[model samples]
Target chain A: MVVNMINRVREQRPLIHHITNAVVMNFTANGLLAFGGSPIMANAKQEVADVTRLSQGLLLNIGTLHEDQVEAMILAGKAANEIGIPLVLDPVGAPATRYRSDACQRILQEVKPTVIKGNAGELAHLVNQDVETKGVDSTGEADHEAIVRLVAEKYQTGVVCTGEKDVGCMEDEVFVNETGHPYLAQITGSGCLLGSLLTASLTVEGNPEDHLMATLSHYGRAAEEAAAHPDVEGPGTFIPRFIDALAMEVET
Target chain B: MVVNMINRVREQRPLIHHITNAVVMNFTANGLLAFGGSPIMANAKQEVADVTRLSQGLLLNIGTLHEDQVEAMILAGKAANEIGIPLVLDPVGAPATRYRSDACQRILQEVKPTVIKGNAGELAHLVNQDVETKGVDSTGEADHEAIVRLVAEKYQTGVVCTGEKDVGCMEDEVFVNETGHPYLAQITGSGCLLGSLLTASLTVEGNPEDHLMATLSHYGRAAEEAAAHPDVEGPGTFIPRFIDALAMEVET
Candidate 1:
């Protein structure tokens, strides 16, 4: 099947609602826009549910977790579940703090997320595998496959573990795409941007696994192209070209 | 007098404490790093004052204003003032919401900021000028110089109004730099990044007027160079190159 997944996203224009952290909001929104998806960020406890109701997908990223934001996310997550729209959870730095851990647990318990996208360390934490993370950056090693599979079965949701290799698991079926650049991790919010891209892709009518792998392949291809650009000197120079590459047609 | 201001920033490496908005945190941090200045963002009310004490300057951005964030900003602003460190305020989207208007008022009333940075419309609101703003983008026109002057005099602080022409006012003295590209406004947080740049620049010894003008000129030069790059296609393509140009030593 010719699955032009991202192009379909451009045509369908799925609006993805994000209740993410402070650091990556602009990058995440811009990346989604570059990849042909609409992004909306609302963070008030009073109107989060209303915002989630209008969006095609909801992304709850617990990076800069605040008490007020957690409350808002719970409301939005519940609304997304009630509306029958797909929800994606990025439990960023869940192991770093008690509040983050509790917030993630509350989300996993109270919300029925369609997909969970995170780093190996974050997913490993979700599946009870020990992996050390400092702040939001994952620094420890883990069996990504085991973590994704275990978390996939436990949460009954698609799981994605992103690193040098990107792995996605949906129940018994697992997929891996190893086409990314090292530079993706060098800059902030690449993983969060991927969560947004995956959420936007999942909103399209297709197999979640297919969409996951496609999004990974597409993002990796874009990163590879951006890193290879002559004008890109370092991480700072690579970001804009990466966004441009996302907007361009690359072989996925 | 020969003034290599940015190189001085690299040599000094001021640790700038930011209690700014959510959307532009990553970009602002990365932009500062690329420009060879250190940026630290702390949000919790408990640690903001402590964090501000360690830094050379504090930035209070009311873009993604929250009640919790306002409290943190107030505490940090007060600490910076007491420590005799400079504070830069970006009253982002002040006219859009009543909460934001009130928040800006509270900061202005309670905090003794050294410099205030914003666009014509955003600055106009502070001096009680009726200029309409949509979200954060300035839609209406005003006397940029007049706005800067009024705000600077009223607050007894240096003021910068950024647009096609960046106007800086310190009491009776005024400086204007006409070197920035239009693409600077196309991306999110360019103004906020400018606020960070101005804050970093102000920390360097010499005239705040000279530093403000030099920083605007440098940023504008970077934007012009980035926009003129062969690889740039649009705003997405413009951002990375702009950052790279910030890293590159362009003549101010």
Candidate 2:
């Protein structure tokens, strides 16, 4: 099933619209291309609606949130909803500041996100649960299963809480994926790039839960392969190898 | 001189405040770290003045310019000037959009940029010289020498016009650096990353012309080394290797 889903993504080559943060734009764009998804990064208010309307999927991340981009995210999210395409939300840095927390909540209340993905801290903060978050990194531990289920049920959307062990919950059903490496934490935008992969995978017509699981597994496996490369001495060398591994089609 | 300049950067560990676009923030930050400089990316207008005041240098890039960020750029640029630190301006995509062009001009008029960097087309647009630029990429040829000299003399700032051959002009003297690879253009934010490196290098107490030349040379040399790696098949794999190469402190 995962193999078929992966193949479908490459076959369809869906265009994914992104209103993400500046920090991970290039990495996310390249990751989408590696995973066989076309990426259009248009965040300006004047054209986000048009761009989102033309895409097969939309991703909203609030890593570097500002007042104008928050408005653009709402505009793009509504447009994506109007077109009835899948939408993914990664509430990056939600626990760090009130502005970020408020913005994420606003986007959540306004747009019906098909999938909500973030670290334990971000997801926990979304539902009024406390978790230690420093800047954009999730520092404290939380019950991933409970948070995933709570967010999934509250928003009626698939929830992916990522860390050493990734838990994907859709409604009451939960899927656990243990396939990533610790080296991923050393690099910036590793979590943000996963949101991009999920956005692309959602373009495939399949079970939303399975799509999220497949993406998590694929990304984790790629990181493992990249970390194990002989030349990947540290995080710096692990990045490009990870990208190359993402481009490689692995069979289940 | 170049070796000392680079060593000074590592020894000083200058904190660079970046009001740059989202597309290359991760790469830019990672590249700055790799090159032995500290990077702080803060764009919120609420705290940009404080951030700029604390940093050794400032980088103002308009690749993903919006109304609020334009204000933050001006705010940060003015703060950098008040502190008497080196400030670099990269007019990314100036020729592509009216907003970008206007913002670049506004910043130039208000802040005395220490070094102004861009491609032939972007520099030409800043000086009212006609050159073809498609989006952010320079599509037509212009006299690099004339544009560099004109902009350098007009703004009384050092000018660096990057292309097949990079021309750095400071007043009557012009230095051409032919040290980059075609593969540098294959990756997004390569130019923006250069700006980050330049921002860090400018923090060194030296001739602005040598600092810009050293930055371009180091970046180009790293790209060449990254492209020559046997494991680098394409742009996907080139990124990590480039970061690793940048981390390798080679002799001048």
Candidate 3:
């Protein structure tokens, strides 16, 4: 199924709209391009709506939310929702600050995404529960079953909680996939790429669960391959090769 | 003088403050890193002054300009000038739009940069004349002696115009460098990197004319080397090799 989905994405290259933070924009663009998708980053409030109107999917990442950027995100999200394009929300650092948490909630309410993907603490914050979020990174594993159940029930949409293990849950069904390297945590924008991967997978698969599964398996397999190469040192070298692996996957 | 300036930049490794557009921000960062300088980019109106105060040199690029970005650029330029950081201006598309032309004039009038870099049309526009600008690219030769003299007299600052042949001029002096591949223009942020390189060079060479000559020579030499390699086919392969050459230049 994962291979089929990968092939599908390569065949049908979808344009994904991103209004993400500045820190990880380049990594996100390269990741999307490697996975057989195009990325269009538009931040101005005047043009984001127009850009989103023409894109296949919209990914809203609130990693570095400011007054102007937040306003632009809301405008883009509402536009995406109106146009029936799939919206994926990455509520980065939600529990760490009141401004961030409030902004995340506002985007969630306004966008009404088909899928909400975040770390354990971010997901916990969304459900109105207290969780420790260390900056933008997740420190601990989530109570996968309990949190997923609560989130899926409340939002009536697919909820994805990512860590060492990844859990994707709908209202009644849940799927767990444990296949990623600890190296992912050492680098910035790994989760951002994961969000972009999910968007790319959804361009191929209609079912949200199928989309999540394909994305997880694709990322897991590539990480395993990239880790096997001893010369691939640290996060910097690991990144370019991972993209090469994704491209190789497309060919085979 | 240009060769000695290049050596100094590799030795000093200054921090460059870049108030640039979103599309070329990451490329500019990577280019500076490869050349042994640090790049700091922040566009918030409130924080631009503070960031500029800490930088060794400042680069202003208007590749993807808007109202807010133009405001931030003006603020940052003024701050850089006040702090005595060498400022290099790349008037990306001043001849393409009224807003851009007016903003460029406003920035020059207020900030009073040490160096002004642009193509023929942009230089003409700065001197209160109408000239054809082919999109973001230049329509005339960058090494034209007449244009260089005209720009230097009008702006009362050092001027560098880049194309197949790059020209550096200040008042009565002019230097022409004819090297670099056409492939350099195929990439998205090549000119932005040029702005960054000029900033780094000026940190080592106090003279804007010498700084411009040094940067253009190094860039042309590196691109020539990259093009000589058998595997260097397109912009993708050229970028990594360009970085490798810059790094090697530092080490050698």
Candidate with the greatest lDDT versus the true structure: 2
Count of clashes, each model = 1, 1, 0
Residue-by-residue lDDT tens digits, candidate 3, B128-192:
66555445556653436677788788778888877777777865789898878875764556777
Candidate 2's DockQ: 0.19
Task: Give the Å shift of residue B91 in candidate 2.
Answer: 7.7
Clashing pairs in 3: none
List DockQ for all candidates: 0.18, 0.19, 0.09
- TM-score of model number 3: 0.68
Winner by TM-score: 3
Candidate 1 lDDT, A1-252, residue by residue in tens: 125787788787787888998788998878887887877676867557866876899999998888898888899999999999989999998878778888899878889898998987888888778887877778888788889988998898989988888888875789999988989989999999999998998888877778888889889998998999897899988888888888775344
Candidate 2 backbone collisions, by pair: A22-B22
State the lDDT of candidate 1 residue by residue for B92-181, as single tens digits. 867655656787999888899999988888899888898865445676877788888889888999998888888888757898889988
Descending-lDDT candidate ranking: 2, 1, 3
Which regions of candidate 2 deviate over 4 angstroms? A22-26, A38-55, A64-69, A82-84, A96-98, A129-132, A140-150, A186-188, A203-206, A230-240, B1-17, B21-27, B33-58, B62-68, B77-240, B248-252
Model 1, B217: alpha-carbon shift in Å? 1.3
What CAPRI-style quality would you assign to candidate 1?
A: incorrect
TM for every model, in the order presented, reads: 0.65, 0.65, 0.68
Comparing 1 and 2 on lDDT, the stronger one: 2
